[model samples]
Target: MSGLRERKKERTRQALSDIAVALFLEKGFDAVSVAEVAAAAEVSKPTLFRYFPAKEDLVLHRFADHEDEPARVVAAAREAGAVPLDALRDHVLAGLERRDPVTGLNDDPRVLAFLRLLYGTPALVARMHAYQGRSEELLADALGGADPLAARLAAAQVVAVLRVLAEENVRRITAGERVEEVLPGAVAATRRAFAGLGEGLSSFC
Candidate 1:
């Protein structure tokens, strides 16, 4: 049945992700090839590509949660007569309340090492930029018919702020700061980043 096959496919994908993470942890991501991952997961390279179009997706897919977030929040706010940017700000800051381990907030050595690898490698760094460009495109669509130029400029600025905040959190944690200690600055950055937007777009927020 389609349902049974779908479940099996999901299991295979999870297996690949798990094995890939383990391998990346053992041997740096840059050192591992798709062939090795395919061998480890007992699948062909084509099969792996069927699940993830790119090797970077194996790791950075975890970071693409916000691709549709802004659009969703904007829609919800409009439906509730809430302001767009303000709603977006609230939605974002609220999401940050969770110290997602994927955010490099935990004391796990593997996670820290992975973060180091991502920052150290030029290819991964370029991949991150490419992902950002894609995300901004999604945000542009979310902006709907708003002032086109303003919407795009606003979306780019928000994404940039978020990227900086995430990088800062990772750096602080790597420097031996606990998540709790890093929380204030992270929240403060959110507020600072949105304060102007919130005020400027008060009518829409």
Candidate 2:
């Protein structure tokens, strides 16, 4: 029964987010109101608030699934007796090959529009920083070691490198470059970025 209830809640949350994003994309983020999103989703403002406490969350929920991805990758690497940094680099390279939106290598029109909306909105950008901070914390926890501070610093660097790489990919794609054209450079950049990290973090984790 509890599982069923959770499933229903997830569906409701996804539905509301879908409705809110469509409305925001059509009318612009600042132009739309929480009240309007709630109405469009056919729920009262209170109910929408129950699911997403902030208006920004209506859009940012799209990233909720990926918040722990870096941490998970590190954990999996440890379990498999692989270097954490290498695992993360491979994971990102694979994402680029598949044009994962999180890697910002996707050129889908809808994804491009969504990226524009996310980066163009100051509030959304600020909130995204908060999300990155959380990712850093999670990765730090996963990279646990005797020197806690070192783990945290390493995590911060890793998260920042990944974010910058993704941003660059998005920039090129949005500037009208084809994903295939950007693939080699993107792959090379990722390797260089991770190689830099390996200089200090290879043995730390």
Candidate 3:
């Protein structure tokens, strides 16, 4: 049936990423070839390309699920008659509490290795920036399509705040702090950051 076929395809996709990441970590991102990843995953180079269009995708594809998450949060917030900023704040707090990998709070060995691969690879970093750009566009559309500049500026500020917080979480965890130890600080930081966003900074001068 269609459902079974979809599950099988998902398994193959996941296997490819798992093999690719393992190999990339073992060696290095630029040093590894798409053909080699295909060989390790027991698929042809063309088939691997069919699943992931580029070499960078072999690693960044792990983020495919959360690619449009911020946009979705914005949309859902509007539907519920709530402001996007509040929704974003709550969503981020939940991720921190759960230590979501996307939030960079997970300290699993594999996750640490994967983060190293991403941060150390220039190609992956560039590709990640492209992804973030697209995310900002989607969020801008959700916020308002009338004024592109305003929407984009708002999205950029929001995304930048969350990205820094997540990276800081990764840094502390890598330095041996447990998620529990970081959660309180993360919660306080989120509240303060969002509050600053809600209140204009003109008076600070």
Candidate number with greatest lDDT: 2
- Per-residue lDDT of model 2, residues 44-153, tens digit only: 99999999999998889999999999999999999999989999999999999888999999899999999989888999989988999999999999999998899999
Q: What are the TM-scores, per candidate, against the unseen true structure?
A: 0.84, 0.98, 0.88
Clashing pairs in 3: none
Task: Evaluate model 1: give its TM-score.
Answer: 0.84
Tens digits of per-residue lDDT for model 3, 51-122: 988899888889987778988998998899887788888999898877788888887888877887887789
Off by over 4 Å in 3: 1-7, 200-205
lDDT string for model 1 (1-205, tens) is 9999999987777778878877877898888999999999889999999998999878766565655666678778878887777887676566567665534455467677778777666777788888887766677667656577776776687667667767777889889887788887777887887896666644334
Model 2, which residues run further than 4 Å from truth? none
Cα displacement (Å) at residue 85, model 1: 2.1
Q: What's the lDDT for all of these models?
A: 0.74, 0.93, 0.83
**By summed lDDT, which 10 consecutive residues of candidate 2 come out lowest?**
196-205
